[model samples]
Target: MSVMLLIEQVLNGLQYGVMLFLMAAGLTLVFGVMGLINLAHGSLYMVGAFACAGVAAATGSFWLGLAASLAAAAAAGALVEVAVIRRLYDRDHLDQVLATFALILVFSEGTRWLFGSFPLYLSVPEVLSGAVTLPGGIEYSLYRLAIIVAGFAVAAGLFWLIGRTRLGVRIRAGESDREMIAALGVDIRKLYTVVFALGAALAGLAGALVGTIQSVQVGMGEPVLILAFVVIVIGGIGSIKGALVGALLVGMTDTLGKVLLPVAFGTVMDASDATAIGSALASMLIYILMAGVLIYRPQGLFGEAH
Candidate 1:
């Protein structure tokens, strides 16, 4: 492999992994703190994208659109938790699954009704619209570089929130002993709502950022949602650290596989056939990683779930 090409691909993988970490971190938080199986998490992500797109289109300000995404997603999440989600807290996993799955249909149809079936476009800000050369003589999109920086900043903030703050203490206490925390004058219901909303906001931010790179359309969240689940599973569910590590691993594996698999196959077979086969196999690399993880530690790398 050419060294420059390898470097570029590694950077691509890093960017992809950071995006996945955003989605997975939120998901893991909800699972860790609330014990809720929310299949509609993807719906919140789609909500963020639509909110950003609509607001940006109206005001022609990317920053305003970003703010709107966070607000809209947090509001939607809180409302849902207060309504449908509250009822399902005491229900079995199957019932929760059935209810959340229904929500996915509701969100998709509602979004289509409001925004139309066509995809909406979100342009990157002029300040971040161009490419910047790195110290290694590599040029990368400024927006993408911003995303990486933002992801790391969020990760650091999340770590501090979970490990240092009073709210973090309460969250950990709730996760470990919900009943005990409630008995000690803590409002468990309110805490759950806050945690859920926080997670929703993170997912929303991810959607808003990704919208600049891809179409902001209905059902867009579903694919990324699936990958996020895979990330948490391999890294260990309910663990933010696990989510970050798992995301990077999945990102690297998938990225490198797509590039290397075809080349290796081409050494032995026709180039076109090699490319097609390699592409197909590369798509499954993350799942293969998941399978490998599950075989050895079903609870996940950082997961306490048994």
Candidate 2:
């Protein structure tokens, strides 16, 4: 590959990484603070994409659709937490998993009922539709670059929220000891709801942003959900910093592996065989990276050893 091509692939990796960060960050927060294993989190992601697509289609404003996505996802998240998740806090992981898995079905069916089964397309906003030239004269998608910037911005905001704000203090405390925080007159239940909603909104934002590049449709979040889980595992559960780092690592490994591995194999083997082998290995790269991380640090990169 030429230098420019390599540079572009790196940028693509970064963009993909940030998107995973968006999903993983929220997931870690919910697990970290609430001790609840929510398998249905991806449903909120779907909610956001559908909301953005439906609203933007009706109003012809991508911005409005984006806002709606946040609002709708957050609302749906809060509702789910109040109606179902709160009950799962004291239950075992198996119970939480079962309940949330049921929620996945509910969300999938509800969304299908409302929107039908057709895939919806979200157009790139006019201002973000074209390619932009980088300093090295590399052309890249402006919207994807925007997604990277937005993801980093959200990461910074989350850091601030968890480290600097009063709510942050409570979240940290809750993570360490929920019973103590509740004894200290903190309404742990309310905090859990807020955290859940925040996580949902982040997932929704990710779905909406990614929807423009891919088709917005039912069951889309399930595949991404699996990757998000891998990200959190590699980063160390409950660590935002870990999530971002892990996301970038996985993204780079997956993207570059796909691009570079075939070339490396091509030098030694027939082109067709190299392509097939490279593609197969590339698909396994992220999971391999996760397993490596676990071997090095079973608790995850940033997860505290208990």
Candidate 3:
């Protein structure tokens, strides 16, 4: 491939990685802190997309839609945690999974009932709708680049929140010993709700950001959720740093594989066959990478060994 094309693909990979990080970050946090298997987390993502689309359509402003997404998703997460998740904390993973899976159905049908079976469209804000030139005369989508920047900014903000804030201290404490923190006067229940809401807001922001590029529809979050789970598994269950690293690796592997694999195969095979075979292998690259990582570091790159 040409140098310019390669650079563009790399950038695309970064954008996709950022999206995955947003989804995975929340998922890891919830799993790590609450020890809850939340199949319904994806539902919060769908909620954000729908909320963003609906509000933006009503208000004629994407900004309002974005805000609505964060609010709606956070609210939904908090409500879910209070009404359902708290009960599951004392239950086994099987119960958590089954209950949350039921939640997926509740959310899907509820959304379909409200929005109909048709997909909703979200337009990129006017200011972010174009392309920009890079140093080597490479042109890239301004919106995608913005997403990469925003994702990193969110990462930095999360680091600051976790490392510098009191709530961060509480979160860390809760992860280590929820009972001790509760004994020390921390409202463990409140902390769980807040953390869950924060995670939900992140997922919502991801959904809203991506909705502009894709259709905002029911069940949209499920596929992304699967990838997010893979990301957390590869990165280590609860490590944000691991999530970011794992997401970038996955994004690069998946994106570059699709581009490069076909060309590699074309060298020795018929063009049509090469494309077909290459695409199939490209689909397997991330899983292969995950398995390799497991072989080398069973706890993941950043996960603490048990």
Candidate 4:
């Protein structure tokens, strides 16, 4: 109810939104460029978290762990692309989904076997572990604010990479017409592998970043993966800008709804009932938002009209 609480919630929403953006960006890119439905993408997220936890524990350096997350995820993605996903490109979405679902099982079980069922924790570095005062005299966690900054930095860098680089041009060309791009002397297969690896790295970065705040455990990526799907669908499947916008929208709506709805309902209902109903609605808000977007703009907010 207080102004400080409101500010803190908004900041929380922004941090969450940015993390979702990181995850959704990769999903959108992979879908746009490769046309593959990878159910195992979330498994890559778990992989990143595990790698970060393991490496950080061994080396006592969060930075090294972060680097390991990126490298391990990228390598895993490339290997998957070459060994399994490449074969699924020409197949139907159903087949792609099934194969990737199998991958999820393999990844989850494999990680459990390697790491055991116990959850791992990643500690925020000492420098980032404290709070900073905001302009309104509100103290906020520095680590969370750092996440927001890092997320935005990555988003901007990704936009530049996709919009200004030669690789971006090739990616666009591949997205538009894979066969034509191949005819034009591009190694389409290699390009797809690179894109998948890049996407996987982004997901890994998100996982590593979040692991500091939450426990790293098996199947940790599934819920976030579903949310990322909602983000891509609401934003438009292949549009990065849409993914960004949709992620922020979903994040704010979900966060604000949870915080504000109960108060609004308390006026009309008992506190307990209001809390229950508000929580339920908050969980459904993003999906409802996605449905509304689909009804109005089938292609998505930033998607090209088809």
Candidate 5:
């Protein structure tokens, strides 16, 4: 491959990794603080994408769509927490899983009913649609680069929110001992709602950003959701830093593996067979990485041991 092509792929991988971090960050936070396993988190992602697509299509304003995505996802998350998820907090993980699974069905069907089964396309905003030349004379898409910047900005903001603020302290305390925090007169219920909504907002932001690149449709979040789970697992559940590192690792490994494996195999096998085999192995690379990490560090790289 040309050096320029390799550079572009690397950029692509970085962009993808950052996006994964957005989703995984929320998943990790919710799990760490609330001790609730939510399967419908992806549905919030879908909600964001749908809200963005609908608003952008109606008003022809990407900014409006973006705002709508944040608002809609956060609102939905808060609503779910108050009406359903709040009940699951004291329940078993199995119950939480089942309830959230039911939520997935509701969300998917509800979205399909509203938007139809056809996928919606979100155009990149005019200002960000073009490509820019880098120092090495390689051209990269501006919108994708914007995503990388935006993702990192959000990550930084989240870290600060969790590490340096009053809410962060409360969150940490809740994570360590929910009963103690509640006894200390903390509004544990309200805190859980806020955290859930915050996590949903992050997922929604990721969905909105990704919608510009891919088709926005019902069930679109499931694949990314699974990947996000893998990210948190490999990074150590509940650790934002771990999520970031794991996401980047998975994204780069998946992207580069896909590109490089084919070339490596082409030397020894027929071109078609090499492409097929390379694609297959590339798909499995992250899972292999996940297993290796689990074997070496069961609590994950950043997780607290039980």
Candidate 6:
């Protein structure tokens, strides 16, 4: 409707997209480097949330909770990699999917057992508890803006890590040919573990960040996990740049569709019908985009032509 409203929605979409990027970034890495389909990645996200909530509640410090979330998720990830996932690495896709799917059940049940079915709420820190005025005189939440900044920072960091560092080189080598990297004296197993842990840590960070805004509860990671899958698929399975672009595209498309479509349809139809139609289409918008992308570029927007 108004310019202010439009800007607000755009910001909301950006924030949402960045969060998806966090999830998708790790997912793409795992798929690209390891060729493993981890269905339990979302469980790592849940693990981070519960870890954050528990620590925050116990210590009365959100920062401590955040740290705990990362540690817990990373440790859990490393453990899963060594114990179960290692076995599945050379297995078929169905086996990997089944094993990780089992992990999702295990993590969810264990979380429910430890935390109970009740949801946990995190308090926004005092410094980030207020709103700030943006350039257009629009008031926005400091916490949300903080999320946007943090997400971008991570993206930059990832770019540097993958593009500049020795680890990045090793990772690229591994992706191109695992056997060759091992032959060249690289500890391929160790590299895979580190990558999985790193990806899991990213997912954890996302969970901790989102936990404050949403409920920290059992099975909360599934929907986000699904969206993350859509992100990776649309972005191209192994491309970080594609993940970023696809996430933003999906985020903005979904958000704008929900808002603008309803308004546009309302002018030509009844309010109830317009709202229903808009909401339905909005939910499907990202998937529709994915289908379109796949039809045109089977590998994805950033995926290498195969």
lDDT of 3 at 111: 98
Q: Write the per-residue lDDT of candidate 5 for residues 1-112, one digit (tens) a residue.
A: 8999998999999999999998998899899988889899999999999999999999999999999999999999999999999888889999999999999999999999
Candidate 3 lDDT, tens digit per residue, 90-163?
99999999999999999999999999989999998999999999999999999999999999999999889988
The digit string of per-residue lDDT tens for model 2 on 1-306 reads 799999999999999999999999989999888888889989999999999999999999999999999999999999999999999989999999999999999999999999999999999999999999999899999999999999999999999999999999999999999999999999998999999999999999999999978989999999999999999999998999999999999899999999999999999999999999999999999999999999999999999998
How many steric overlaps are in each model, in order? 0, 0, 0, 0, 0, 0
Q: Would you list the C-alpha lDDT of every candidate in the order shown? A: 0.91, 0.94, 0.94, 0.93, 0.94, 0.93
- lDDT, model 1: 0.91
| Candidate 3 off by > 4 Å | none
Number of the candidate with higher lDDT, 5 or 6: 5
* lDDT per residue as tens, model 6, 111-175: 99999999999998888999999997999999999999999999999999999999999988888
TM-score of each model, in listed order? 0.98, 0.99, 0.99, 0.98, 0.98, 0.99
Query: Clashing residue pairs in candidate 1, if any?
Result: none
What number of backbone clashes does candidate 4 have, counting pairs of residues 3 or more apart or in separate chains? 0
TM-score of 6: 0.99
Scored against the true structure, residue 164 in model 5 reaches a CA lDDT of 100
Q: After superposition, how far is residue 249 of candidate 1 from its true place, in Å?
A: 1.3
Alpha-carbon runs more than 4 Å astray in model 4: none
